[model samples]
Target: MIKLQKNVDCVLFSVPPILLLGPHLAPALLKAYAEDKGFRVVCYDPSPGIYSRLNSKEQEGWPYNNFEEVFKDKALLLEEVNLWLDEVFKYNPKIIGLSTHAWASKFFIEPISNEIRRRAPGVQIITGGPVALDLGIEWKQNGWVDHYVVGDGEEAFLELLSGGTNHPNIDGKIPVPISQEAFRALPEPDFSDSDVEYYKQKAKGNRLYLIGSRGCVFNCSFCNVPAMTQKYRYKDGVEFAREIMNAQERYNTNYIELADSITNAAPNEFRKMCHELIRLKEEKQLDPKIICFFRIRRAQITQEEDFALAAKAGICRLKIGVESGSFDVREHIGKKETNDDIFFSLEMCKKYGIKVNLLLIAGYINETEEMFQENLEFLREIKRRELDEAIEMVVVNELYISRRTPVFDFAKDTGVFDNIDPEDDLARDAWQTQLSNGEMLDPKIRRQRVHSLKKFVSENFVHLKNLLVFAADEKFSAETGS
Candidate 1:
């Protein structure tokens, strides 16, 4: 493990308004990667510290989801950014890497990067993560960033630090996904540089985040995974299991959250990992439980035996993206799971005593009243089958039109986004969508459905909880003054 350095070669940062439970994983991974190559690297997550500085009244208005709120007033934003910069410049790192993965962090990148550039003229500013993968070219063209490392940042960043450039995955030229064999050989993320105790205190419990894989097996229309990652790749089962065990030993936490898009995307590897975890638990007398996002597939592929092994392996919870309850909507969105498949998945979870969290979208592009009713009925059936006991929560959100998604292209092709500028990258949240029946679905209808679903779930199920969240809600409220 690399200890904190007073004067480091690189200082990695995670921008503010990332009000998540655990610490960001990117900086820790980057720190480990950079230090392995003999570069002195220190990681900083000043988001919590920066957010705590705001007054109670100011905090109330600045919704946690909207990063733009922090940037609305340049003077106030600069004051906050400068306070953070003061801490970073103390290290006097030659290279500064900003983790621009979260979409909300996008708004902070410009203000934060500009300040870094102004304050430390000699420091090279590099940006990476999901945001960089999508809009690296724009950020580069704007001249705020010296370089951008898209896709996987570990190797690309190390190369940049070694004075190498013109690589396909660096300098905003293009992103090349790192191969699976390469991913398997990477070192464990060094959390020693992070305020681990602070994150543990803030989190629901003592928890750590890890990813066994990169990319998703299924390319859902509404998801940006395919474009972002290019291909599915996972660490070997034995290696990943050991990584989990090692993380638990170091972090002193049995609660692990898998950051992979889908935990069981590679069924064979997943089973192998579970088997290894089960073996390790028995041999070492260690009990480490995992919570991961899962994809429901055919029974033969994602069998009940898989869930059984997962339970024995100490997987306590599963967050499944059951995007819509309507079959047609699911199919259209590239999720091939039938109602039967969903029920079977839920049944297996129930059988294994694993808590389930269902993710739902309220207003898909073509979701009609009939389709929505089917969604409601799906919930009713869960209650009927007593699957609600296994379901801990259902999170519902309004459909977002993110750039580079298949849904976004479809919206552009249709008349829904006719009035919007083709070059407008900021207009990601659209309220209006033309239904299959030639009816326009507006924001009001979507909000109603979102609320309606929540109400139904709350009223009907005893154990099943529902949370309605959307990043666009704050922006819409500010615009309409509702």
Candidate 2:
């Protein structure tokens, strides 16, 4: 393996927010830096307690289901950070790169930043990722962080490491485009130095991490993808397939996670990649579990052939961003999906026997009780159609509205977001509260929205129970078939 620069060893630290998820983008950045710039990379994850609990749960036959469960373990969170600090001190890296993501940003970065600064005052502290972008201004104002990188960090990070320029001004503005060629040329992420088996064992055969594409084409108001990655770009399919095959071979594992913003944004390109995977499987070149994010637009998956191709490629799980059930809200959020489109797309996934995870954002600028009820009704309709068994519903409360997104503009125009604070604690708390309450325009309507949402969830508890049972049965069926 290639080593990094002699004088300035680089340590890549992923301060994952107590979440027992799969591999993150930090390792990929490490590999990119090492290959492209020859930086000696050491990866430290300060979340071992979380990993331990995850392993225990996996052994007990109940794997972690969501990011919340993994992050809520406070004890694990502390222990992991301590362990990570020890490892970092051993390396004594000249530069420390903190891998930031959206969910973990709220709780993880500040403490990690404080610890790093306290322990190693001389080391240059750099932060990157969507979370970094969202909170770059805040970090800049604080003295802990030396530099904050927005957008893709591969090229800019290397430039910084080479002493090409002083860290860019952290004005809380998004950075310009980094060349896609840099990402393509980046070496496969270096997880070999870390305890790969530990993470795999924790996964219990239900985890993988990947990145075939970066960014999204659509400008969804509430989403950060557009702001983070201004353009959509993809690695060549053959290259992606090789990466997957390599990871599977190295880890002795098959579960593959596509960490792309949208895996199937370009239909023809995606189909071609799927066909390549099928070919690889046929030639015994690869055998891997696959999960990917796909837009639920009917136009993307209109033909039966496309669905068949996707299945043949081993895409077993599809995460669709079905943001809302109401047409107006969908349009308002720039999703452009009608109710009919959602139903048709869902039915197609069911027909293909692919597990579907529906992602819903609860609150927006002008969300109404009627809109929330429409979503509940849609869920009921899905349950009635017996598609609930194939679908897992994930509703997330919004936080940290990006200043660049359409939602920010909407908030400003509608007077909902009068207080703009990149750092105020109370403002952040209010934002979370508004998100939980569905951001009802009128105070009276807020309760109704919450009540309707609660009612829908309560009414569908049996359906959810049955869906879980069905999922277990399906897993058994697949294992038996294998």
Candidate 3:
């Protein structure tokens, strides 16, 4: 017998994928709404188990063994969903909000949305996140989602929860189409009542995620940032430092993952922030590992001083969006980069002993096989060098074409995408068809190419590690006779 709580105004349920571990946008937005409407809010995240598996803490009572193992099986996902449904039923709030992002839409949104609808027909179901904006009309047509909030959700969500019309104004402190005021107003994310002990146990070591800034200035063709109208806004440097120190004191956090799209977009602002961080570290004797994502212009990385400062500030890992190896493809997609810039940036990061995660896309409009092979060969060369040195280099593939990105527009104009429905399942299925017969390589061929690359990486990873070590430590040359 399930008892319903009328006192509960809204319940926020966040379903994030295992691969992405960071502060969620929807949860933060709803937190603001809860504060505004005086509604009791609760967040249901399956991410604890996901994080446990990814961080290899599942051996202690969690279900999955590792990230790879958990993500490979759909049964595990179904089991997790059942557990989530049980938890949601226990809360039994009036309004249910489903949070989604692009990466986890297919795996997390579809199955859970259907189940929630079947069981809890009385509860109003709303979906918000990146996919909400990208596929809002499609979702609305499906009847699974009662309302969709596009752009920053804080204002729109509050109105909806207060029984306002479903389609509310997109104006408020937060920007509708790229304003920094809204980002500035974002209160410190409410993680106080969350299952801190559970996450801590999963983390195993000290771990913290910090968002020092919001939005991105660059409009990379494959990225969804531009469409979100994310304006670049920085939290006060001093305030950010205080948050870091507070987290350190509370959680004994040894690693800080900066959850910004580009950490160094405003070089001077970031430098100031880094200076404060360094001061805190030196004065307080606080030592924490740092990892961040950034888009490196050739000019920025070539400056030895910049790389040195980043290394000194404890930035051990850096992710760069090197979408393609071909200069022509880069220009075609509106990514302003030359081949020289890409190689230089990689070498500089290598020289600074920073781990590099290079993101590559395959199914771009008008992508040539020769271009892909060139990218593959470049990765092979990097792997070969890693055999001699002790630095880490990873190459990940991008398969999904984001609706808001220029690539989608290109696909539409080029007749690659004949039927572009916004519904998640239908659009995904339609995209698969395009992937099969479109200008890019056939689906079968793409799978074969990916499998071959994976095999090559698996066999040569050990050598790559050795090379990384060699690069970092001079003594490796004498020992390895390279």
Residue 460, candidate 1: alpha-carbon lDDT: 73
lDDT tens per residue, model 1, 72-174: 7889889888988887888889888888656667678888888988898888888888888767777888987888888878888888888787667896545
C-alpha TM-score for every candidate: 0.92, 0.81, 0.75
Write candidate 2's Cα lDDT for 169-274 as tens digits.
2333766655678657767776655566666665665455768777787888877678777778778887787777777777765478888878878777787788
The better candidate by TM-score, 1 or 3, is: 1
RMSD to the true structure for each prediction, in A, is 3.5, 6.5, 7.8
Q: Ten-residue segment with the worst summed lDDT in candidate 2?
A: 473-482
Residue range 1-482, candidate 3, lDDT tens digits: 22344446667777565323333445754675476558777666766655544543444323212334555677776676777888777777777887776443545666677777888878888877766765655666777777777766776777778878544422221226424666566666665435555545545433567777767878777777766755667776666666666666665655677778888777776676667777887887777667788776767544667777777767777777676666666777677766667666667677777776555555444556666677667667766555214235444353556666776666666565565563343354235333333344544545555454445554655533311111111211211111
Deviation from native of the Cα of residue 235 in model 1, angstroms:
0.6
Quote the positional error of residue 441 for candidate 3 in Å.
4.0
> Candidate 1 has what TM-score?
0.92
Error of 1 at 55 (Å): 4.7
Q: TM-score ranking from best to worst?
A: 1, 2, 3
Q: Of the pair 2 and 3, which is ahead by TM-score?
A: 2
lDDT of all predictions, in order shown? 0.80, 0.64, 0.61
